[model samples]
Target: MFEQIKVFFMKIWNELIITIIVGFFIRSLKKSKELVKPTINELLNNIDYNSKNWKEEIDKVLEIKTTVERHFPEYKDYLLIQYGSSVIPDNKLPSDYDFIVLLLGYPIEGNRYMHNKGTISDESNETNKDQVDIVFRDYLSFLFAASAGMPYENSVIYNGKLVKGHQGYFQWLKNITKNILFDKDFLIRRFKEKIIAEKQEFHKCLKECEEFGHDEYYVIRAGYYYITSILQLRRIQNFEKVITQNQVIELSKVRSFYEDILDDNIRNKYEQLVENLKRNNTLDLISIDDIKEVLLYIGEEYDKNK
Candidate 1:
């Protein structure tokens, strides 16, 4: 509860900063920005894109790097994953394929989530229904949050191969999440009533990818979308339960129950990002035009591959 209050204030602080930046011109704006703040904006603007040095941490986790480039190539040059700590310092990069997709996504067709109450305009304690816990949140979702304003870890792609990790590799998108998006005919029938809860929420996650600037964050979070995918094992996890009882209960809901995410510090960061987006008027910054560009890019790429 106290942590929530801290989160509330942090969010406030961030929004204040954004408003100051967007509302008026301050000669000291650049100096006011957080230095070494571990934000995507900082990384993009500061890092030398030509750096040859990168993470050589893991010899096992393979899925990390390839996943980033495939879905989020814009960040291909900057993302990397290290396996152990102490071997490295002050650069505690997240898992190999961090910051891939968007999570805490906006609403979609059906599934709706929680919201915060009691506030004064931007100062309110609003919690978007989409706020899933960080651990259960698909680490990539966490990565996306981190990448929004921090430096994304970097890596190099070699003929579609990684320098190290092999067994740790994984599928691109979650099977369930993908199937929901595939949104076809017979495929829909096969899925039948299997949608336990928050079906629209699935699509919302996809939509969030586009909304959140469709940068390195989307690619990283997309992998964790696979977490939504463990739907295949839902029946067994739930002991032959169907429809997840209500909207909230699910066999895999357990995944979203990680306590690590509830930490005040993490929540503080989440609040800050929300505040920044709101203050910068970056919250819905991606428009219909951006969506069109993305669709066109995807189409052209698809055609070329074919």
Candidate 2:
């Protein structure tokens, strides 16, 4: 009789422990959801351009240009291509100056060569939020990349405006940009490369999502790139110039096509993820499996098209 009583009590104790553990897990999930709610709300509603400091921001960019010119006088013939949020009109909190310093009269070193001069930040003012990213490349290399339909070049060069450069260099860049769209072979090769690169990035994001418990940012980023890649491929097929990368404008341009191409459920999930991310600063609610599914779908589509 005592043995039977002991066995019954032990079983009850084990069951109670499991119930407590399950309760804690559910509570943790709920707590994480709550924590992310406020950030999402703020992201969705904050549309202020904060353009009152435009002159100040321009001054900062010019200062950085002067400093870069002074330091790299040997490359004084470089073209300064300005891009990113700072260049976009009505961009909220445009905080950084992005530059691609293309050195004219330099030879291409083995296809292409790139060197990055890390970001510079102001130390004098506590509230100074200005930053500069200076990327150096030979002019020939830049032209080649643009002509070859390199994904990075497609996104950057097409959107960039010459902030400070010689008239001749600007004209050359403009002509080359137009001519590259006609190179069918180059566009085909570039499309293939983009597919490989995006697939690799998707896998890396999937791994990170599994380990970090947050797939929202990765999913949104992957979805954007996937859609962008598809648009580029379609443009190549139709002999159209790839569109410029104004996130709001460009995304909208491809939205209808993207919606038609992607599975309905995947499309809806991606849209929701983007909406959530735009409002929230943190990644909290997401499913890794969903991200993987979308990525796989994108890859399959690319394969079929290629």
RMSD of each: 23.2, 15.0
The ten-residue window of minimal lDDT in model 2 covers: 121-130
Tens-digit lDDT track for model 2 on 1-306?
999999999999999999999999999999999886432113213433366654334434345456545544445466667666557877875344456667655333532332321222232122221233355666776666665655455456667777556868767766766534335555567677766676666666657766786534554556556545665565556643453323212423343454544478777655544433333322344455655566567656766877
TM-score of 2: 0.49
Question: Model 2, 225: alpha-carbon shift in Å?
Answer: 3.3
Error of 1 at 211 (Å): 26
Give the TM-scores of the predictions, in the order they appear. 0.22, 0.49
Model 1 segments more than 4 A misplaced: 1-38, 55-98, 101-186, 190-196, 199-281, 284-306
Cα lDDT tens digits for candidate 1, 251-282: 22333323323445433333333333223223
Error of 1 at 54 (Å): 3.4
Best by TM-score: 2
Off by over 4 Å in 2: 1-78, 84-139, 150-159, 165-167, 179-186, 201-227, 238-257, 272-290
